[model samples]
Target: MTARPPSPRAVAGRILRHPENLTESEQFQLKNVPTHYPELDALIRHVRSFAAMLTGRQGERLPDWLAAVRQEDGPPGLHTLAAGIGRDRDAVIAGLTLPWNSGIVEGHINRLKMLKRQAFGRAGFALLRKRVLLAR
Candidate 1:
C-alpha cells in the first residue's frame, strides 16, 4: 500500500517546531513538505528565522527581517504580519529584547476572567472574589 500523505496540521506543527526537537520520521516528513507545496519553503524559512530571533533575543535583526518579508513575493499573511509589527515596532522590539515578562500577571488575569465567566449569574461578587483569592 502507498503511504498516506501527512495532514496539514502535522505539516504546520513540524514547520513551527524546532529542528532539533523533530524525530527522524518527522524530519523526513518536514523535508518533503516543500516538494508538496512549493510556497511552503519560504514560509518554513521565515518561520524558523523568526523563531530563532525570538529565542536568541535578536531584536536588533527585526528591521532587516521585516524588510525582507515586505520585499518578498511570499504569502499575504507574512506581509500582514510585517505590517502589524511595523505599527508597533518599538513595543515589539522591547518585548523581544527585554528579559522581563508579564507572564505571571497575565496568567492571573486569565484565571480571574475564567472564574468570572464560569460564575456568571450563578454567583455574586463575594463568591467570585473568594474564588479568585482562594484559587491556587
Candidate 2:
C-alpha cells in the first residue's frame, strides 16, 4: 500500500500533540531557527560542526550557573563561575545561585510511561484517563 502524504497541519498537530518527543536541545534549535530551513536530516551534522568544544568538568557543566561559593565574611551575592575556571578571584563577590533543572519533567514522563505499561491492558481508556488525571 502507498503511504499517504501528511498535510502540514497534520504534521504540526502531531508535533503539538507529542511535543515531549523533542529534546530540550532540539526545542532550543527550533526557537531561533532561520526561515527557509534546510533538510532536517542535515541539521544535527551542521549544528555539531558549530558546537562549542567543552573540555573538563567546567566545560561539561556548560549550563550550570555556578562553580564555587565564598566565605560569609568574604563576599555577598552569586559566586564567580568562569573565575573558578581560571582560579581568578579579583572580582569575586557573593555565594548563592538559583536552582534549575529539566530532569524532574523527564522523570515524571518516565513515571507516566511506566504506570501506563504496568496497567497491562486491564484498565479501559476511561479508567486509565481517570488514573492519570486523578493521580497525586
Write down the worst ten-residue block by lDDT for model 1. 67-76
Residue lDDT tens for model 2, 30-78: 4333332434323332223213222122233332323222221212222
Assess each prediction's global lDDT (C-alpha) against the native: 0.91, 0.42
Candidate 2 local Cα displacement, residue 80, angstroms = 34
Model 1, 27-98: lDDT tens digits are 998998789888888889898989999999999989989998888778789889999999999999999999
Alpha carbon lDDT of residue 18, candidate 2?
A: 31
Which candidate should be chosen as best, given TM-score against the real structure? 1
Please state the error at residue 111 of candidate 2 in Å.
Answer: 1.6
The reply for model 2, stretches above 4 Å from the true place, is: 1-57, 60-100
